[model samples]
Each structure stands twice: as C-alpha cells, then as structure tokens.
Target: MWPEGIGTGAGSLPGADPREAAALVTGETPEFPALPELPHRSVGADMIGRTAGLLVDLAVEVVPTGWRVTPRTGRDLRRARDLMSADLDAFDDACDRTRPGWVKIAVAGPWTLAASVELASGHRVLTDHGAVREFAASLAEGLREHVAEVAERTGARVVVQLDEPGLPAVIAGSLPTASGYGTVRAVRAPDAQDTLRELIAGIDAPVVVHCCADVPPIRLLAGAGAAAVGIDATRPAFTGATARVEALDAIGETWDSGVPLLLGLLPGTAPRREPAIADLARTGYDLADRLGFDRRRLARLAVPTPACGLAGATPDWARRALALSRELGKAFADPDEVPAGGAGPA
Candidate 1:
C-alpha cells in the first residue's frame, strides 16, 4: 500500500512540459512521486483522453462536444497514444537519478469513464450495461500492460490511483445527457461498488481510489478493496457543522480500520497571503483531534496533499504547493520538529 508520512499530488499539473512536470514532481515528492498529468497539453493529455487511449479494443475520437466511441482507431486516438508514450519517457528520464521506490500513476476510474464517454448513439456508455462491463475489462487489461511497462522502465513498484471524480454525479443521477435536456438514470450503490471492485481486483498493483467530490463514497470505495482512499478533508462537505454525519462517520471508520488517507489540506492554487507549512497542516491536525485519534496517529494514517489538481494554478504556485506538501508529510511524521510559529511562506 502507501508508506507512512508520505505526500503526493492529485495528478494534473499546470504546464504542458512533460519533462519539467516529471522532474518537479519527482524532486518535490520523492518519497511517493506521481506521474504528472498535464491536461494543458491538450486533448490527449487530459484525464479522459489519456485513459481512453489505454483502452484495448475500444477507440474514442474527439467530437465537438467531447469524446465519443468510434468504430476504428482514429487520429485522435493515435495522438493520445503518442502523448502518453512521451510522458512515460519523460517520467523514466526524470526518475533516473532519484529512482524512487514507489511511483504513482492515475487513470479515470471505470464509472467516471463510462459517464464521460458517449456511445455511437450519443448516449453515455453507462447507459448500456454490457458496454460498461466491456470497457472496464478493456481498461483493466490496458492498465496491466501499462503498469508492467512503467515498472520495467523505472525499476520501481507501481501504484495505481483510480480517479473517480464523477462517481458522485453518477450515483446521484446528476450528470446531464448529451442533449443536456435530462440526466442519466441513477446507478445503484451496490452495482457501482461491484464494478469498482472488479476493476480493482483486475489490477495487480495496490490501488488507491481518489474522489475529490464534496461527498465522496468513502464507504463503498473502502469496501471495494482500495488500499487507500483519497479525499479533500478541507472540503466544506467534510468539515464543521455543515459536514454530513455519514461522511464524517465514514472517514472516522476508515481511519479506525488502519487504512491510510491521502488527505488534501493545502490550497491547489495561489493564496492571497502565502501560509506557513504549519498553517496549511492545521486542517489535518484538527481533523485528527475531532475524530478522537491521537495526533501522532496522523503519522501513520495521513498523507497531506493539495485540495485538488494544480491544473488551474500558476506555475510557481504549483511548485510551491508540492514542496509544502512534502514539508507537511515530514511534519506529520514528527510534529515536534516543526517550528513553533510556522515555517515561513512557501
């Protein structure tokens, strides 16, 4: 699974430079570096496009609205493959010096992919149960090959992070149809969990299920065999009196089970006034106290990160955020070592 006191990104950085992104992430979060996803690079580099390119037999092409299934491999699919290959090369080159023991790579989870991609009929793939199953199987096969290649290239154990930012919308039936006139039918929780569990079981590596939504399905993901669950602890839906009791209970139970949490506490974008590492880490510290866990338990159960992806951040803020995240990781492991007032502005 995950190492104690580790920090990493939620994927997607600000720039289009793969080499730079790889180097920055490896340098900043060496203990648990993640493969940088640069959506700014264009269609192929985006979360959906990148993951779509990994499909075994399925092919997707970009339409005016978005990506849709195609009968055959198209130029869009080819370009996506090219971008992903170049990124892998960049990651390999960047890690040549550090050779981190563990590396993370993210892909769109099955549910999100289904909800986002459209079939030939202009309906979401999730609308067809058979198609959904087929896509999941293809994705699983693709991921296995992708993992093997990455492990071979970097000589490190690969950690698969399944990004499910769309799962909440899918479960709530809030995702608009292609026509935008109606919503897709809500998916049953049990069905979603089963699909996710099968996908996780298919992959060989330890899986981390990430969902930055206001109300991430923590209980379902945890039960589906995620080695770790990623969420934004600072999200309004997860904190204070406004937070849902079910969400709070799920988080507390997740920790009580000894499953590490990739807790997002720092701002992903630039703040008006730069805060100290101590200031940024307070959310996590306070979360531990409120949950009735000893502060030291954070060292074992929490890994600090930005609230979400840094794609919208300025280049400088992105780098600073990663550095601060690393610092917070160290602080989690040794709170006494942090300065009294706070470390200066990152």
Candidate 2:
C-alpha cells in the first residue's frame, strides 16, 4: 500500500467580484490559495492557471471543444498550451518557495478522448482503430513534452493521471454504436489494454488511471503497468449487500495484483458537523476491513477524499471539507492521543 495524498479536481480561480474570471495568461490577481473560492464561469486555462497559482502539486485540464472543429480551434489550442506552460512556471516557483515530493498532471485518456473529440468529417476517431492509435501516440508525445516542462520548471518528479470515465462504458458495449455519423465499434479488452500500455510506455512519468465510474477493468489496468487505480469507493456501482461483498472481494484481488487502490471516501457535499471527522475515519476503516485489508494499512492504501470534486459545493463547504480531510488524515496517522468523538481542531 502506498501512502498517496488525497486529491480533488481543480479548484475555482480567484476572480473579480467573485464572479468575473481573470485572464489566465495575464491577470494581476495574487496567487490563489489552497481553499475553495466562489464559482465563476471559467475555461480550462483559467482552471489550470489558478490551480498552478495555488501551488497544487498536481492538476488536471479538461478543455472545452466542439464536436466539430470551430473557427477558434487554433486559438483554443494555443490558449491551452500557453496556460499549461504558465502553470508549469507557477509549479516551479512553488517548488522553490515550498518544496513538495512530487507533482501530477492529468488528461482525458486516449480512448475517451477519441470518443469525445470529433474529426472534420463529424465522425469520432474511435471507429478507426488505426487513427485512434495514432491519436493516442500523439497525445502521449504531447503529454511527454508537458511532463518535461513541469519537471524542468519544478525539479520534481512528475506523475501522469489519465481520466477515463468512459472506460467501463466502452468495455460494457454501452457506448452508442457508431451510426451514419460514425461506425460505433466496441474495443476488445485486450486491444484496449495494449493501447493503454503503449500510451503509458511512451510517457516517462509514472501513470495512474482514474475512473469515477464502476470498478474499471482492474486486472487490465494493473497489467498495463499503471502504478495505481482511482475509484469512487463511497458510491460504488454494485447494487445490494451481496454485490457489495463481491465487489470488495474483487478489489482485494486487484490489490493482490500489485496496483494499489486510491479509495475515495469523502462525501461529494461537505459535511455540516466538524465531528464528522470520526465518521470519516470509521468509513475508511470499514472500507479497508471489507476489502480484506488491515486497518493499519488504511493509512497506506486509502487516500481519504471527496467522492468527487467540490466544484459544485459552496465555497464555505469546500473549505470545510478540505480542512476536515487534512485533520482526519492526521487523526488516521496518530489516533491514540486525539479525542475520540470531537471535531478537535480542524
């Protein structure tokens, strides 16, 4: 079990009037703090800029794009590149100011990207395996360059996380069939596994794949050489008590395969009571026990986190959640002297 840090999706950027987005490339706003902020309409660059400004060691970028290429396509790409570069600069400055162990950068995985990013002919590249492979290779190269930029700026090791919410869907053949718009074809498990392995092999950084959906192709992910798999543990896809039991068994098997699991335990919404710290600890312990792992291993394998990002939460709630998470982590590490049922000093 690895003692990985808890993670959240990118936080909101500092803005004018708590609603106006600052130009990511050129804004005079002070570096954003680690706490959450008032939600303002923001683009991918704004999110990345603010995240980097906050000194977050790791962040993910989800740029918006049309199904078909638009008039501002080149501009959008340029903006994205510039924003990423700026974030790398910010990351470097943070490393100089407050050194951290490692930094992470995440992007949508190739298969999911192929499904989402449409071509000029209004067809998803997923239909063409050759094109999809090429797209994956290109993305890998782009990500490698980005990783190198971050590493050069920060002088810290880089880890790449690939967000693949659509993986389970693709495996289950639930993704819509390619019709006249495109030929929708399901990727075989082995082929998908090989493609992911190639993508990971191409990048120099350690790779992690995140699926907020059901237990992903766990064995496949492990086989693909991913260091870890992130899943929404609090709200698992299995139904009923029996299914839950079975799911735990499966997770244990996956762990046995050597890929550590990053179990998400935080609620999507922030909790009201500070005393919820105890509940959080208990939840972590319970999940570990059910998964056939020892409670002591909890601090190692389990990264207590909100089931998802706090973007939808109010600023107050998000701040509270982060504070609570840090506090509970401390408790998990050393609980003997801490008060058993109180919020303590979060």
Which candidate leads in TM-score? 1
lDDT of 1 by residue, 298-341 (tens): 87888888878999999998998888888888888887776665
Per-model TM against the reference: 0.96, 0.76
Model 2 Cα lDDT, one tens digit per residue, 117-223: 55555566676777677667767777777778767765557767776777777766565643544336678989889999998998888887777775666667778
Q: lDDT for every model?
A: 0.89, 0.56
Least accurate 10 contiguous residues by lDDT in model 1: 337-346
Residue 3 CA error for candidate 2 (Å)? Answer: 5.1
Model 2 compared with the native: what TM-score?
0.76
| Deviation (Å) of 236 in candidate 1 | 1.2
Report the Cα lDDT for candidate 1. Answer: 0.89
- The top-ranked prediction according to lDDT is 1
> Which regions of candidate 1 deviate over 4 angstroms?
340-346
